[model samples]
Target: MKQFIVELINDRFMIAAVLLFGLGFMNLLLQKNLIKKIIGFNVMDSSIFLFLASQGYINGRIAPIITNGVFDAEVYINPIPSGLVLTGIVVSVSVTAFFLALTVRLYGIYKTVDFDEIMLLINKEAE
Candidate 1:
């Protein structure tokens, strides 16, 4: 148990990622408001990026940039994971913006962003 605790403490980024993902997932699943759901989605997205960035990080290494013709693998951390995380962040932002736009349109038409209320209105319209 002590070893586990020490390991967990050392891997702070993993713990943070898990917490963010869990919180976001709960919010997404349990909330009725569209805005809240969007926020949850953002939280989960950030957690994923955090996890990826953490995977790329090393204790005492710089970025994988060749400086002055000195090329040693040990001096530089792998850059791919960080690059992927950056791409994921950009995509997540765009997706969040799109979702918010849709939510705005829904609110304009229904005057509310509650998920159940929107479903009820749609069902009533259908019948």
Candidate 2:
């Protein structure tokens, strides 16, 4: 039990990622405001990035960059996860910006950012 607790403490990033993802998903699903939903999505994106970056981290290993005549895999951490997370961050930012733009346009049209209110207005317009 002590060892398990220690292991869990050592894997704090994974635990944090899971908690962040769950919180974000809950907020996204339960919130009625478009802006809040977008914020939740951004939170989830950050948690995913954290998880990915942590997966590539090694306690004592150097980066994958090779120098000093050292080429052993044990000495270098995997670079793919970090690279992918960097790309994901760029994409996440672009996507969040796009979503915010759409939210602004929706607010302009409906005069509100609440999802239910927007739906009601759209329905009333359709009728």
Candidate 3:
């Protein structure tokens, strides 16, 4: 248990990412407001990006930039995680924008951003 605790402490970034993800998940689950849910989604996305970035880094390795005519693979960190994080960021931004636009339209129609309220309003209108 002590060794596990020490290892967990050493991997600070991973621990932070997990905690952030938990917070975001809780926010997403508990929030009634659409905007807050969106914020939580963004937080979750950020945590994932952080995890990927941390995974891409090594303690002693340099970035994947080849220099000095050294072509050894061991000298540089893996570039895939960085690329994945970048792509995820772009996709998340687009998704977030789309969700915000939808929220705006929903608010315009329902007069409230609370998802439960919107559902109630819809049921009332249907009845």
Worst 10 residues of 3 by lDDT: 65-74
Residues 1-127, candidate 3: write the lDDT tens digits.
Answer: 9999999888999899999999999999999999999999999999999999999898799999877888998899989999999899999999999999999999889899999999999999999
Q: For model 1, name the residue pairs that clash.
A: none
All candidates: TM-score? 0.91, 0.91, 0.92
**Per-residue CA lDDT of candidate 2, range 50-114, in tens?**
99989999999998888798988999998999899989999999999999999999999989999
Compute the lDDT for candidate 3.
Answer: 0.95
Candidate 1: segments with Cα more than 4 A from true spot: 67-69
Give a tens-digit lDDT track for model 1, residues 1-127. 9999999898999889999999999999999999999999999999999999899999899988887686888888979998899899899989999999999999999999999999999999999
Which of the predicted structures, 1 or 3, would earn the higher TM-score when compared with the native?
3
Off by over 4 Å in 2: none
lDDT value, candidate 2, whole model: 0.94
Once fitted onto the true fold, the runs of candidate 3 whose alpha carbons sit more than 4 angstroms away are: none
> Model 3, residue 38: what's the lDDT?
93
- Per-residue lDDT, model 1, residue 93, is 89
